[model samples]
Target: MRFYPATLSRLLAVAALAFSPLSWAEQAISDGVYEIHYNAFNSSFITPEVAQQNGLMRSKYRALVNVSVLKLQDDGSKQAVTAIVSGQAANLIGQAQQLEFKKIDEGKALYYIGGFRFTEDEQLKISLSVQPDPNKPAYNIEFDQRFYVD
Candidate 1:
């Protein structure tokens, strides 16, 4: 399948807005210098065509988590920061799954994304560790997310 850059750009723009920290009161967290935003959505949101074009696995039982980190500049402007990101998801039954994150760089935009499979209406506790830079300390994050297949 041939994926149009313009289409992909549009999709990403929409996703960025949907996942922006500003849109959610508690979705974003800060560590004095950096702000991290993380969220998960059902894979069904991405159509099979888009998934195939983007090299993503599309399945109703899968969920995708998107993470974005930004540095707070002196002038108040935010800049995208490169980070080594990884996480794990676990459910009440003690079933655990490790997330395999993929880094994506698009000009000034940088972020990490990972996918995991789960049963419908399953709730997961996600723990993510991010190292913003080689010299910077890693930040640990935890959040609860629920996925529903539609």
Candidate 2:
């Protein structure tokens, strides 16, 4: 099972995982050269076989976070770019959780996947910092989402 962020996004969307379209309204941060798409949803949306093949724990109580970086080419196309990503999730009650992302690189596509457990009615604020390369500046992104196991 190849862990492509776009592929996972489409699968999660079909499974009612609350995935937003790839528009500007979604959690996208761009630095004129690179754009990052951030997606998080309930892990129950993924099939057990796919989850197992991708090294993800298949549980309704788990949330999967994915990030993809794209570099805009001069010829009007987007290219997947690799980056170092790190982030954390926190609740309103001061409960903090760190995100340990596993990087996957397939050809020109790169993605970071991470999982965390959450309660049925809790909201988590996620923050991520991505550095595309040694010469580029880091991009910091912040967003809030609530996960429900039921």
Candidate 3:
């Protein structure tokens, strides 16, 4: 069987894509802090009509935040932290801090986390602790919103 140069190139490209790191989801975690996992998607939220109506003369930007805490080890130790998944959307520019948390309906001590329109270049601070009972620590998480313009 003889393969043309174009056919061989196509096969190589497919193999490269299959083995590329970009083809897999990326996950990163900051020890004793939080974990984030995400995959790039199509960026097509900006429309000419929206730019004209909303007075946005530049390209639009969007990002997803998936953060959470793993376990609760000790008193004053932040744990069980999770990012609030809200439907709130905002421009990557400007100043805004929108975050909310609620107790989880299931599990021994679980909670639901969510946030909206977080626009900042500072690291978000999440503090968890047990007030009266050091054994039962709560979670408080902060998210530093960062943006990358192209």
The model with the greatest TM-score is 2
Return the lDDT, model 2, position 74. 97
Cα lDDT, model 3, residue 63: 28
Angstrom error at residue 147, model 1? 1.1
**Mind giving the per-residue lDDT tens digits that candidate 1 earns over 1-150?**
666555544564465456433335456789779999777776677668877766777788887777889999999999988899999889978798999997766657776878898897788888899888779678888888776775
* Candidate number that wins on lDDT, 1 or 3: 1
TM-score of 1: 0.83
What is the C-alpha lDDT profile of model 3 across 58-125, one tens digit per residue?
Answer: 33233222223344455645444344333223343433444343333223323333333222332223
Better of 1 and 3 by TM-score: 1
Give the TM-scores of the predictions, in the order they appear. Answer: 0.83, 0.84, 0.27
Task: Encode model 2's per-residue lDDT on 54-105: one tens digit a residue.
Answer: 6887787888788889998999789998888888989998787899888766
Better of 1 and 2 by TM-score: 2
Comparing 2 with 3 on lDDT, the higher-scoring candidate is 2
Give the TM-score comparing model 3 with the true structure, all chains together. Answer: 0.27
